[model samples]
Target chain A: MHATALAHSNIALVKYWGKRDRALNLPVAGSLSLTLGGLATTTTVHFRPELESDLVSLDGRELRPGSVAHRRIADFLDLVRNDAGITSFAEVETANNFPTAAGLASSASGFAALALAATHAAGQQLTDAQLSVLARRGSGSAARSIFGGFAEMSAGTRADGRDAHARALAGPEHWDLRCVVAVTTQGEKDVSSTEGMTRTQETSPLFEPWARTVDADIAQARHAVETRDFALLGRVAERSCLGMHASAMAADPGVIYWNPTTIEVIHRVRRARRDGLQIFFTIDAGPHVKVFCPARELSALRSVLSQIDGVNDLIVARPGQGAHLLES
Target chain B: MHATALAHSNIALVKYWGKRDRALNLPVAGSLSLTLGGLATTTTVHFRPELESDLVSLDGRELRPGSVAHRRIADFLDLVRNDAGITSFAEVETANNFPTAAGLASSASGFAALALAATHAAGQQLTDAQLSVLARRGSGSAARSIFGGFAEMSAGTRADGRDAHARALAGPEHWDLRCVVAVTTQGEKDVSSTEGMTRTQETSPLFEPWARTVDADIAQARHAVETRDFALLGRVAERSCLGMHASAMAADPGVIYWNPTTIEVIHRVRRARRDGLQIFFTIDAGPHVKVFCPARELSALRSVLSQIDGVNDLIVARPGQGAHLLES
Candidate 1:
């Protein structure tokens, strides 16, 4: 069996920072995100009876068999095999159109594509909800990438994590918003999201309160999306992003992900908003800044963001489709 | 009547962040501080019947009568006048050895000196505790500056704010520690501590948790001080500082006090510690970093800190005496 799938990266309008369950990758808070149009990952999976072990490759480079990346893929494949009741080994190949591990949410698109491709190649016909849950086990944010446009992940109360899967809140046609990604650094972050989250959860005294307040923020974000209120959406999104980073910064040893350029971008965004541009910024664990703006103000925001020193490139993305398997 | 006093600036070993009563300038958490030896503010107060208004001058620059700084001084004078039952206007002159409003705790020393001078100038012989309460009305951290070496400010439960005052933990002779001030930016911050604290209290979700846990941190820090455990004291001190800054960063508009150079200094301190040097960093609402180190490591810590690019000046301070009358 062989399958190929494409998945777009999703930027959380309302963030999912800390996790409730590390093993299952269950988020502690509800989050809302928009699946990005241009930045995506394409993955292919082939299950062969003749194969003895799983092999993983990224952008044509074969990863070491027992390496961390390879082991992650193998573990994900095992989940698919258990579900499909197939003993055949698989070969998985993934490639992304954007930078990896630079706070671009590449893992979200990567794992989403891998989950769809692997499950389909294993002769499994699962609904998007089931696939979302499965992808979440690989990377929590990947659960949201299973849906297009506006998607929400519930901080589910279920102990089994059945209710934790993301669901589509609205399709791409519902809003006319644009995201301009200001790539300050192309290199991967020194600390991974997994490690950073663990450090934040363990050492930050503020983490508990931040995690507790996410439900209200998610509700506000949902209402802002429903009303198509760009300003309200931006406010909630930026606040959530700041709160998440705050927890990380308050960790015992402290984690400072922002550089001089990052601070400049934040100030620039504030100045633009003061100058009557309806734009707001959100950053994940890395230095890059994603400015969300209304379609009409996109050009103006782009001009300002482009002039900022240290911004190597800019990517404009509109709302896009969810992860889907391609016929093979 | 006239009086002059000198007071040393105190850097919080544990910070005094939020205020429980904005009007009275009462803290939401108890704080510990080390009164700096070299940085002092000298303030003189003279009351005359013919003076129409309370005139204020800082470092030979006469402040406008209705200006914010002028108003704060006049307000503080009113408290002293009310206690002594005097209706005379006063002229106040203050000067500092260190930069003002660069988060070197200038206001702490300034108000403490002014409070002692103004009250005495008005013929009121108040105790140190009474002077502390009056100084806190001008600046909260100034309360701790009324005591030498290790000082603690109580976050009193009294609604009247009478119990919120500083008390000495130990004299400067109790410990052989040094503070090296790394002045990264000479320019004043965009947001003042008063404004920043108010914004953090109002907008930051993390502020509640941060305020809630300060007592526990204070206990830990006190224990560390008692046992002469530099590592444990430094750990608690740095964590408290981080938590304070985190709350500011999580504020609605967000107040980021650190620049790239500030971050570099923090990393350098951590590196020095890893290399067997006992040094820790603490920052207030400005870009400068203050590194606390053992007496033995002073030269090495200074050498490393001096090489950092943006560090304009370094001030070495030992624990010293608090506010006292300056003979004129």
Candidate 2:
């Protein structure tokens, strides 16, 4: 049996930083995100009862069996097999519309699509909520990618993390905004988000204080989304993004992700806002910057970002749908 | 009465960010700093009975009446006048060996020299600790410049700040270390350090957590200094510096002081460490960076910093003497 699924990438308005439970991938706090239209991944999973081990590939290249990426996918597929009660291996293939380069974190879409495809391929009939929980085991942010438009990851306090899952806050049609992603640098991360978050929580003195502000930020973002308060959303989103980065930077030895271009883009975004662009920028765990603005201001913001010297590329994105089965 | 004093600038190893009591200029935590040799302020205070108001000038440019700089000096003189019980106005002329350009905060030396000269000129007899208390009224970091070589600003728990003052940790000859000051940019600051620190305390979510780490950093640094453990000192100092700036960056609108070059220097310093140069970088509220190493690495570190594209100037400094009377 074989199944294919597609999922879109999302950027957090209220960011997910450290995790409360690393083994369960339970986020330290609830976060809000808007799914993007252009950047996405499609995954195909096929079960082979006679095969000894799972096989995984990205784009057109096969990942080595014991490689970090290959092991991640195979380990995730084991959960799907366990749920379906199948003594079988699987073949997984994933492709992304965006480049597998720096700045873009494809894990959310990749894992979300994989979760849907693997479960369906394994003869498991799981609901979207169940799929969201399963996807989180592969990647924490993948839970949010299971829903469309604005979504919130609930940082449930349950010891077993049964209550932790993301839910849709509103549909794509609810808010008509654009996010222009500025690919500012090609610097590879020294540590992955999972490793870095652990470092921050353990060593950074500001981690607890930063954690305390997340609930209020998430609350404010929810209100802003309900009322279509772009300014309020922008304010809290920017604050949340910077506060998270500040904590990471405070870690012993520090987890510095931003290159020179990242900082330059930050200044340009602030300057553009001062010149009345009405745009706010948010950065994930990498060097790229995403500028959020009204649909009408998209072209202007793009032009502004394009003029920046080190901004190699600009990808325009809008709110899009959640992970869904691909009819193939 | 007339008196002249010279005070050297100092860079905090464990930085001071926020204040406990804004009115009394009480620090949120104790801090340690190294007095720099070349960068200094020599101030001549001449108390006169006939002058209508205090005359203040910097580098021979006469400061206009009611100007910020003029008012600051006049206000500081008021504290000295109160101590000596004299209302006589003073003519204050101060000159720094280093340029009064961006990145270098002249306030530490300026206020320290002012406190000593102003008090002495006002016919007031005060110990070094007492002068430190009076100097802090003008600037918080000035308190640490009261002593030579290594010094600590004690954050005492008294409401009146009677127990709060700086004390010498060690003499200038105790450690043969050098700091290479890399002035990366000439960009003007959007907010003064005092205003920025206040904003961080009021608005930044990461403030309290950052403040909590200071005591441990201070203790670690004290041990490093006592034992000449360069690595330990560097580790705590860098963490302390980054933590303070991290809190500032988490402010509401965010206090962004680093320009592009500042970030570049940070990367270069980190990279050089990877290449076997054991130098640690620390930044204040502005864009400049200071590289700390043994005296032998001074030339090599200067070469490393000067090779960076936007590094405009490099000032080599060693442990220096405290504020003292001039021969004028």
Candidate 3:
């Protein structure tokens, strides 16, 4: 019997936008993210020799039997099997603790967790980097979600994307960084990351400057993390989020990701900047803003952010653990 | 007798966005532009001994004696008089055939014409380089506009900015390029180039990539003009415009110069790409699209572009001649 297995994917403060080498899923800039324990995905893998083809079901709903994600898993299985000289058909059942394909990199973290479970189900063990490369084939950001604490997805140099992998920069104890996920809109994300990135690459003039900042932020962030410099962390985080949004304005039929209330919340936080408040915000493909505040100021920041008109719910998240499995 | 002075200013396709060293007005990127005959400014300078102070007028309206533009002229007079060993205040009068301060780089042509007339009035024989450097103090883009045809404003390495001067790459008649200017909106620009470029230099993510694109476009545009290759000209011009817009997107309150009509015109032109039509569009600080079409396709493109809604007016322009004073 196969028991259910789950994992968490974190949101990046430094965004992953363009591909340096698309074939290897290598990004143009290195990205940093914080993993959260509260938000995660549970995946179960079942392998049977009797099954004719691979199938994937998410949250009790079977997806188009062989979609892009499904093919990715099948391909991974084929590779691992070939290396191990074993042949088999497998079924992957994955469900999110959050939402699937909902603009959150749930798929990134979801597929990454699935990769772990499926590979384990085949009785094969691999290093984290090796696992990340396998997961990146599913989604570029997923590879970064495999590690906890402060993580950096090195933009690989090789044309094949072999050097591209996520590495842990600092552990959770280094800084008391706290994130509050304010769920603004839970509806289908209007823009897909795939289309959004492509539009940004083709149209946004800000993309290059955004890339340069990532490098600068990486160095500054590392020092900030090492020295526990909350001010530096807040500044870098705020600037990175602002840089990503700037690219949004240059997209064809340009639209900002912020809802009316999301903007209001950001403003309130900005207003609090004068008080040396450590509150900063970053958003991905969705309208929600992941407000990063020091745990010491969590109560104060939460009170103000919660009062924002459109914020649906606020969840306080601390540092999360790396990938793991459930024992049967 | 009123002297008729018709002077045209060139527009840099690779814009002179930011001043790297502000005191020197040193730009970060070299820019290229075309002077147009249909759109220009005409000015006449006359010294009046009756007025205790210098008086300036535009069209038929008398401006404040202490106006900033008047002050600039006074300052220029101080420099010239000190350099030439002469002292006298002169009255300056100017008028434009096009809209003033409507984000059209009016000063580019305006100041160029004014500089030429003022020089003649002062009885100072000046070289084109001296005239260009003088015009630049009035407006950076104006320096380039002083020359006709393909021109570039070099971002000088010297601190004094003496090295920064516009040079003609080719005269207007070097290539039979047809331009179609589609007016999308007529109003004061929300962001001035000074404020906008400062923001871009400080915060734009696309700045570095934009700088690289400038270099590439300058080289390619010069080649296209020399070779009279319409395809290459269209390609480089469009890329340069897009690159310029990219910086705008990265601003804190990111906004491009495009209105809805501007978008429509660009899309229609792109859709027509499959028709083997040689066409490209460039926009500056206004919501207008300057389409670079081959001479043979000008009427056809104008006909198609005119059909788009919200377009206020469409004007056809040809390669322009250098600045000259028209005697009456």
Per-residue lDDT tens digits for candidate 1, residues B1-328, read 9999999999998988899898888899899999998899999999989999998899999999899989989998888888899999998889998877557888999999999999889988889899888899999999999888899889999988899999998888899999999988543257888899999999898998999879998999998888899999999999999999999988887887877568768877877788899999899888889999989989999899999878988989999898999887
Alpha-carbon shift of residue A8 in model 3 (angstroms): 5.3
- For model 3, what TM-score does chain A reach? 0.91
DockQ, per model, reads 0.58, 0.76, 0.14
Steric clashes per prediction: 0, 0, 9
Instruction: Give model 3's docking category.
Output: incorrect
Off by over 4 Å in 1: A185-189, B186-188
Q: Please provide, for model 3 over A274-304, each residue's C-alpha lDDT reduced to its tens digit, 9 standing for 90 to 100.
A: 5677687777866677888788999988887
Judging by TM-score, tell me the better candidate of 1 and 3: 1
**Off by more than 4 A, model 2:** none
- For residue B167, model 1's alpha carbon misses the true position, in angstroms, by 0.9
Relative to the real complex, the DockQ score for model 1 comes to 0.58
Q: Lowest summed lDDT over 10 consecutive residues: which window, candidate 1 chain B?
A: B185-194
True contacts kept of each: 0.63, 0.80, 0.22
What lDDT, from 0 to 1, does candidate 1 have?
0.88
